[model samples]
Target: MDSNKRRHVGHRRDNTVLPLAAGVAVVAASCLTLFVKALLKRNSKPTQKQGKGREGGSAPKSPGAGAYVRGMREREYVRLIPDVEMLSLQSLLRRIQKARGWQFRDDAARDQAWARVLATAQSAAGGAWPLDFTPNDVTPEQLQALCDAVEAEFLGGLLAEQVRRAGRPRIRVVLGVDPRDPYSWLSGLHEDNTIFVNSNRWREEVSQDNPLVFEGALCRSKLEALAHTLGHELTHAVVLNFFPAMDASSPAYTPDDKHGPVFMWLNRRLFGHVGHASKRLFNT
Candidate 1:
C-alpha cells in the first residue's frame, strides 16, 4: 500500500495530549496490576462450575453467531497486548481522582474492581500479544503489519459478529509526523482504516534514552503506548464504519452523541471492557 494514502500525518501542537500516549500510562498501571492478581486467581484451581464453560477449550459463543453469513473466511483471531508504558503506583493513585467515569467508582469495593478485571483478562487470553518493536522507528513493513494486527485483534472480531456485512469492513493503518501538534495520532475514516501517528515524536521517543538504571523499562513503555494507540484508533474506525449514520454530516454535525451507550458496548465487545473498560477510565 502507498504510504501517504495508507497513513495520515498528524499536525503538531505545542501542548495538547493525545489519548494514545496519555491514556495508556494510566491504563497499563491500573489494569496490569489487577491483571497479575487475576493470573494468580486463575492459577488457583478451577471449580466444576467454572470448568463447565471450558469443557472443550472451545471458542467463546459469538454474539453475532446466528446472523453472520460467510464473506471473508479469515477467522484467525489474533489478540494483541499493546506495549503501553507503565505509570508509578503513586501516579496511578493520583490519577484515580480524575477517573470520574470508571466502571466502578472510587467508593466501590476493591473486590468488585478485581472481578471485572479478571473477566477482562480471561477474555483476552485467546487473543494474541502484540509484536515488540524498537523505540526508535518502524519500517514500512512493520507499520503495515501493525495495522493488520490491529484489525485482527479489535476490528476483525467485531466484524465477525455482524449479520449482514459485505466483503468485510475494509481498514488499513499507516504513519505520519506533523510538527507543532501535541497529539500523538489521528484516524482517517472517510476513506479507509488509516491511522496517522506523529513520526517526529515517534522518532524522538525511539532515540530517547533513560538513565542506566532504567534502560529497557522505558523502551517497553514506548511499545505499550504504541500498541494502545493501535487498539484505540482501530476501535474508532470500526465504530465509524459500522454506524456512519451516527456521524453528523450535516451543518449541525458537531452536535451528536456517538460516544453513548452503544459505543461503550462496542468497546466491551471488542476489547472486553464493558461499561467503562479502559485502563484510563477518564482523561485527567
Candidate 2:
C-alpha cells in the first residue's frame, strides 16, 4: 500500500510538470517566431532617399542628375496661384480700409490716406521695388496681370532654381478664391504641391494704415509684401522635395505648424540675412 501511494504521487507530479513545461516552450517558440518575422519585414522594406543619413543609415548611390531626375519623375508635382480682382483706386482704397479695420470718411479721403501710407511704409521698409521685389497695384483690369507677372518673374525664378537643384517634374498653378471664407491666405506643400494666396489679405496687409507687420519689420510696399509671400511659399516647395518622408510620418503637419529645424536650416542656408529679414518682416 505504501509503495502504491508513492507511485501515484510521482505520476501526478510528472503529469503536472510535463504540461507546464510544454506550454512554456510553445510560448517561447511563438515569441521567437514573431520577432523573426518583424526583423525580416523591416529588412525587406525599401529605404527613403534623404532621412536615412540622419537616421544612421546610408542611401544607395545612383548616377548624376540623370538618375536624380529619373527618380523625380515618379513623383507628382503642381503649383497653384489664386486669382486677383482688379479694383479702381477708389474701390481699392475702400477695400483696404475695410480689411485693416481703419475708419475713413470717404473713398477719396481713403485713397489719399492709402497713398501716403504706401509711400511712408515703403520708405520705412527700405527696399527697391520691381527689382528686389514686385508690387501689384490695385487698378481696374490689371490685378490679374500683376499676379501673372509676379508668378512668372518672381515665383518662376524661385521654382526654376528648385528645378535645377532637384530636377523638373509636372508643375501647374491653380488660381481662385475661397468663396466661403474671406480671411483665407496662401499655403504650399513642401514637396510636389500647390500654393494658395489670399488676394484680400494681400491687399489689406500691404496697405499704409494697416501694413503687415512681421518680425518687427513692416511690409507696406506691394513689392515687399509679394517678396515675403513668395519666400514663404517657396520654402514650402523646397522642403516638400527635400523632406518628403517627414511629411508622411508627422501628425503635426498643418498650415500653422512650423516644419521645425529643417525649415529654419533651409531658410538660413538659402536667403541668409534677407531670409532672416523677411522672416522678421513677416513674422513667419
Candidate 3:
C-alpha cells in the first residue's frame, strides 16, 4: 500500500513538471518572436527616413517650369476676336516660330497679342477688326477660361476654315508665361504644328501712359501695337512658309539688323516687309 501511494505521487509530480516545462518553452518562443519583430522595425526606420529625405530634397530643380508658372500666375489681360481671322493668323505664326525654334514668356500676353493681331490681320485681309480692345485685369484661371470659351466659340470654326484655305496640316496656338524674362515673342513650329507666343514684353509695352506702339505711325494708326507685333511675327512665319529651310545659320538669313536693298527685296518677297533690314544689314 505504501509503495503504490508513492508511485501515484511520483506520476502526479511528472505530469505537473511536464506541463510547466511546456508552458516555459512557449513563453520563451513568444518573447523571441516579439524581439525579432521589434529589431526588424528598428532597422527599417532609417531606410524609410532616408528615402523620404531624398524625395523631399530633390524638388526645386525645375527653374524653367517655375518661371513659367510664376508668369502665368501674374498674368492680367484677355482679348477676344472672331474665329476665322484668329485661326488664320495663328496658323501662320505657328509655321514661322517652329522654323526658328523660338519661345515666348507668357500665355496671357500671347493670347491678348493674338486677339489684337487677328483683328488687325482680318482687317488687312479685307475683314473687320473687332472693336473691343479694352485691357482686362484677369487672373490666369480667368484667362484660361476665356481661352476655353474662345476655342469653343471661335477657334474651331476658324481652324476649320484655315485648314481649307491652307491645306490639311493642323494649326495650333500654344501660349506660355515666363517670369524669368520680360519680353514678348512669337514662334511658329513648323507648318503643321503650332504657334507659340511670349507675352512678357506686351505687358510692359502696353501700359496706361505710353499705350502700345507698332511699325512706323501709319500701320500703328490702323493696328494696335500688339497687332503690329503679330503682323511682323507673322511675316516671319510667312517668310518661312516659302523658305522652310532658312534657319538662323543660313547665309540667306540676316540678323535682326537691317540688310541692304537686295536683302530687303528678298525679305519683302519672302517675309513680307523690310522693318529690321538696316539693323540686320549693319550687323551682318
TM-score of each: 0.36, 0.36, 0.32
CA lDDT of 64 in candidate 1?
27
Report the alpha-carbon TM-score of model 1 versus the true structure: 0.36
Pick by TM-score: which candidate is best? Answer: 1
Alpha-carbon runs more than 4 Å astray in model 1: 1-136, 155-169, 178-190, 203-220, 249-261, 272-284
- TM-score: model 3 vs. ground truth: 0.32
Q: What is the lDDT of residue 200 in candidate 2?
A: 49
Pick by TM-score: 1 or 2, better one: 1
* lDDT of the candidates, in the order given: 0.38, 0.40, 0.37
Which digits, one per residue and each the tens of the lDDT, describe model 3 over residues 101-126?
A: 33233344344544544443345332
Over 4 Å off, model 3: 1-169, 178-193, 205-209, 217-223, 254-274, 277-284
Error of 2 at 157 (Å): 6.1
Clashes of each: 18, 12, 29
